[model samples]
Target: MKQPLLDMRGIVKSFSGVRALNGVSIQLEKGEVLSVCGENGSGKSTLMKVLSGVWPFASYEGEIFFEGSQVKASSIRDTEVLGIVIIHQELALVKELSVLENIFLGNELGSFARLDDEAMYRRTSELLARVKLDVLPDTLVRDLGVGQQQLVEIAKALNKNVKLLILDEPTSSLTSTEIEILLNIVSELKAQGIACIYISHKLDEVLSLSDWVAVIRDGEHIATKAAADLTQNDIIGMMVGRQLDELFPREVHDIGEVILRVSHATAMQAGASRPQVDDVSFKLHQGEILGIAGLIGSGRTELMQCLYGCYDGQYSVNIELEGKEKAIRSQRTALQAGIAMVPEDRKRHGIVPIMSVGRNITLSVLDNYKALFGAIDEDKESQDIDDYIARLKVKTASADLAIKNLSGGNQQKAIIAKCLLTHPKILILDEPTRGIDVGAKYEIYKLMFALVKEGVSIIMVSSELPEVIGISDRVLVMHEGKLKGDFGYRGLTQEIIMNCAIKEGA
Candidate 1:
């Protein structure tokens, strides 16, 4: 019989008065991957925080035994020193720095004297090779797309000679080919006796890669079983403590007249290599979810940006709303025309982190509630904010609390709530659930269904294939600034979409 590499017993954690983890236990064998599967706010991340020392020894009650020795990790550095590394839900690479610099950040070698440029780049190349990423070591982090940046993060962790690697939603942004490469890397790591704690909302990934599956729900451990032993329904039942009827509940609804029409819309940067978004035309019908699916760098985002009037691009547009032609030269114009856009980068573009939750929600609709004398409407504003907070299940101490205090899921919900108040006819959600957890994703899906039922046309651009397939009535696949394929929801498959996205002949 072989000894286990990692063992956590009687783990308990809390935030203020709310218990996040209660008496959870897990075990991992050397060279095996143990997947943690749970809904959002289910304490999977909290348990990982405890193990990685984000919640220090004194803050959480737990016993972590690594390599048959009891260890109390007081800081992230302490855990790192023991060859344990965590790649957080939000990536930690310094955008301004080069790849080599980011990989060696805080964990720099040849430290006391100065940085060893030659040695660092050499090691970085080796690590990159292991991960199947062939980019130059000196490339800036900011220049890379989300998927490429994720590979860089993996390379950074591997550069630490990590024994136990923890990945949170690692493949969320990756393409299918990239996911294959990552899975191969994980298998290679396993061959070398390295262990992994894979945390993800992606069940297929968890089932495919894991040897054991641990389920947690509402701060308590439900069960841990072999990956092959549990059915998909079995896992879901454990996570939510009930059955999820449909991942994409596409209830039949009538598609009315075109609510939005964009003709020959173009967005271009001055003196750049061709326009960011070339001449494009599309129409969205009321009560319809039109999903835009494309690889990163496709013109999908730029088209949405143009529709929302987010930039002063060399722009020429013909747009129609509700049978009337309208000009949207600015964000104000777009908002006035009953269009709302949820930007892709929620933290930077979609939210005001330092602002109070109430203020952030009311920002888009301030004029409607303003007093006739131009005085502020404090009481009404507070009430509206509170109403949204309750409706969206936004977890906040109070409406007055800063937006930065909420978790990623809660923040995303707040953003949706903010947009909902605008009474938008056409809602543009660009990567709406990019960094959100599964439970939050379910909530967003339900919200979308409800909105569609209410006759609000939605244009959603998503990198997630399952999401696009599940929720959309129709999908548009883009390639190299062009629409490559268009299909009704029932007619699309992962294989068909992939072929269209990469097929130059198409």
Candidate 2:
């Protein structure tokens, strides 16, 4: 019986007519790591936002007790002053700024009218060392990869003298080594009596690190139990309110003839230390879901980019479609060849945030929805948009709503629907379910099964082992810009795949 460090009672949050969190309650003890589990739109992030003052005092109805005192935070500054900090899924670092500058961007070292660069840099270097990123303090954020950028975000949080840290999908983009370092840091923090609220879809890490677990379903608190008392299946059951029959609905299909093939693919970028893709060669056949598994910056993205012709270079990658060679030098060519790519960052590259759902859904197939002599057919577009919205089960009032109005999971479904309209033969999905919730992940997996049944080939790159193992018919492990091993569904296990990902002798 240690006294609870923080207690949230009767939390109720709403948006318009929809309830995001309804009378949910939970508690955190000093030095305790409590994991909040829920699918997308389940109110986990919303709860964290409330705690971190992203929602502020008057925005929601709740009583938050911190250190035996009722606290009302007016803003993020107030929350930080109470020693509570949050690292969001979409990092807050400025790419153009150096590591030290980004870390101390708002919190400068000197008194009100002066700047102290030396003190800031020295403190930043110490923080970086604590996180075990020995890179130079002057290195710009854009110069670092996604994994390193994640560490920078954590370091930024540590700089705030955080006592209660809320991390939303902190390891989504980290490498195996980086993940271990972060886990170690959490252990150290706990020893010093710092509490943590880790929100992640990565169940293995959740079970390993969390002392207690709380599950939320559809904005309702389901249960809170000790880590040892609950299993992964129990967490899933609590989150979705039902037992999931299978994690991945993988089906066996006859392998068809080679539909897409890449040979000797190479990309050269300035000052990258190594080629982004080094003579990568692989063949993708019809009715196949080829999964490319790797850590961040291991060249999976670059390989796909090269195949889609997004890089600038004298690359010599031979492509064979229907047993004949074809030149693909641009994105237009890739799309014309019936290849559709669902990029990694949906907000940045996948969709137009401000546009209507109808417009976003019909953007890819607009050519087909046009009348004679370049006239756009509004009726046809509306009908097709309606069909996709229903098909994807997008939770929206109507197709006329702004794309930004939907939740992250629904936004992802909209992007997938947009790609489906292209009716491509080969589909490339990069971290398709990165920030989405469990129910949304199930929907995406079902969609994939339906697509594969229709003879479309899929190339998925994911950091989640369950996703890679569950959905892929075959897994290709990439390490240090090269394919290290390949495993079929029948022969693959998480342990073996991880071993392949980090082979002997580096």
- TM-score of model 2 (CA atoms): 0.92
lDDT of 2: 0.86
- Per-model lDDT: 0.85, 0.86
Instruction: Give the per-residue lDDT digits (tens) of candidate 1, residues 360-389.
Output: 998999997889799778988888898888
Note the clash tally of each candidate.
0, 1
Residue 5 of model 1, lDDT score: 85
Q: Which stretches of model 2 miss by more than 4 angstroms? A: 1-3, 271-273, 312-314, 371-379, 484-487, 494-500, 503-506
Give lDDT for model 1. Answer: 0.85
Off by over 4 Å in 1: 1-3, 269-272, 371-379, 395-401, 435-442
Candidate 2: worst 10 consecutive residues by lDDT?
A: 307-316
